[model samples]
Target: MTYTVNCSILLTELPLLERPAAAKTAGFDAVEFWWPFETSVPTDVEVARFENAIADAGVQLTGLNFNAGDMPGGDRGLLSWPAHSTEFQDNIDVVAGIGERLGCKAFNALYGNRIDGESAERQDALGAENLAKAAAGVARIGGTVLLESVSGAPNYPLLKARDALDVIARVRTESGAENIRFLADFYHLAVNGEDIAAVIEKHAQDFGHIQIADSPGRGAPGTGQLPLGEWIARSRALGYEGYIGLEYKEPAETAFSWAIRA
Candidate 1:
């Protein structure tokens, strides 16, 4: 029943070193972030600084996500598109190597969104093929990638847990990459009106890391509709051994910055 904080909250305010420091202040022993390689790009010295922060704060690096563009006008789905390009494989290998060196075993491989004029089945096949390639690349470096689901109901079509699982199954069947798994996010699950606890229990075998934030506002634990603590307890009860990632927005005030309940 341990927890980790996402570095996205303090990214703009704190530098890399200070981000872990803040997490420790907030009573977390580990932290995760969304693609820190560029924004908080870690040089050798900077990586050393981050290592010191982890040691000083007694925090571990939970997971790190590679950038997948889902911004407006960008077609960001990784598996939903072709992934065999030499460029894509090279990028995955490079980042995955970095992740392994940093002692981070888990990374998020987000399939951004479905591109226009692509049939549903076509996108699914493309996404699976690309993801399997990326998974193979990541597995070579002793790291695992989590296929995250995004639900863009009012926008482009999103990938659900079932879709992510399907991709995982396909990769296992076709390429047999053992490292790739699922990053079950509560916020996105709630957005799609899925059963949070049930999903965790049913898909525990495929899950590598888990993330949480209350529904509706996507704010801190108790501020919104989702029963975060209950869900956490269920995961724990189901024998989840990975870190629970807190990927949520903080209140405007600094005082509420790291406040977490349950």
Candidate 2:
């Protein structure tokens, strides 16, 4: 299983571009960011600086979580948010252009908390329609829009894997867009009682990328219940050759050297 690190956890002390060196030092081959646009919004000079940083560190840009306009404290949602539907495609166009410039090929669309008055069916329909629109634009840039399911609870909605699967299948079928897929995060699966490997196998075609954090604490893979090596083996057996993103918080250590085989 090839490994990539999300720079959000490590190098929290510096700019996004500077995180690559620390990521490389910690033995990662690729790096991902939640929202690079926030740090340097709409400026090619800053974008160029980030591109140079990746080039210098020799790390590939795995993917980016699309800017949901929350990094600046404006809102914690994306185009999937009903309020932003009209401007959603234009927003995607801007981000897709940035993705094209940076060589990243994947993006995430996470639906936040539920609307107070909407029924489950209405929300799902809106989500499918908006995501399908975004996916069409994403495909033009040779990137994919992955609909991520966070555990639904007091704090979030659309937390169920079955719900996300339904939306993805319906949208793909309706839009006839093929590049859209699912981003399975083990942390959410652990919270929602879904078997990680079972879900992957069940939705083989929709599975595109993965992120992992051990259950109970959302720590490094081996730090909790997840069997890292076995998962690696199973993923390969299942014909998954994409990046397995390491997105967990380290308590005190700079690298997960114990969990990773040298």
Candidate 3:
């Protein structure tokens, strides 16, 4: 029943380096983020500053995303894209180094959107290879690479739980790396029109990490109609012991009011 804040999404008001401390001030002992840097390979000074910020804040980094291409510009991730395979491969060590220093273990690899002319078969093959590389890269720290089902990006593939799970199976089979697992973000699954209760009933214990935001507007728990608390309780009841990441959008001042009320 532990909770972690996703600093990338929740603390948008603060500067990137400052969000870890902000999360600590808001009473979170653990936090997660998408790639904090703009480039796949940031400078040594940049890496040191990022690591130091989290350490200074006294919060544990529980999860992080691989260098997904320009998120605001609509680039979802680099893993499945044929052109950016080099950048994706280059980012593995940088991600693992940060994870090693910060004690973070879960690494989320966003499956990129389909290219205009590239066949789905090519993209799928490249994705599986890149995911295998990422899996091996983080295996040093006993890390697990996470595959997530996403929403809102029309061309982005892997919109359902089974889609991600199928890829996980492919990676394991082709690469023989057993460290890959599912990132069950309830909001996205619900938004994609999946059967949430049925998904949980079948694969609750299979998730490596969990993220939450209410659907329809992606707001905090009470701002939407989603039964977030109940869903989390069901996951825990079924043996999900990982952090419930608060990856919601809300004003920082009142972001946690629903949690406080609960």
- What CA RMSD would you report for each candidate? 3.6, 2.8, 0.7
lDDT of 1: 0.68
User: Candidate 3 — worst ten consecutive residues by lDDT sum?
Assistant: 253-262
Candidate 2, position 138, lDDT: 77
Each model's lDDT: 0.68, 0.71, 0.94
* Model 3 CA deviation exceeding 4 Å by range: none
Where is the poorest 10-residue window by lDDT in model 1? 253-262
Once model 3 is optimally superposed onto the true structure by TM-score, how far is the C-alpha of residue 227 displaced, in angstroms? 1.0
Off by over 4 Å in 2: 39-41, 71-76, 117-122, 152-155, 259-262
lDDT per residue, candidate 3, 69-107, as tens digits? 999999999998989999999999999999999999999
Which is superior by lDDT, 2 or 3?
Answer: 3
Of 2 and 3, the candidate ahead on TM-score is 3
Error of 3 at 180 (Å): 0.7
TM-score of each: 0.81, 0.86, 0.99
Tell me how many clashing residue pairs each candidate has. Answer: 6, 1, 0
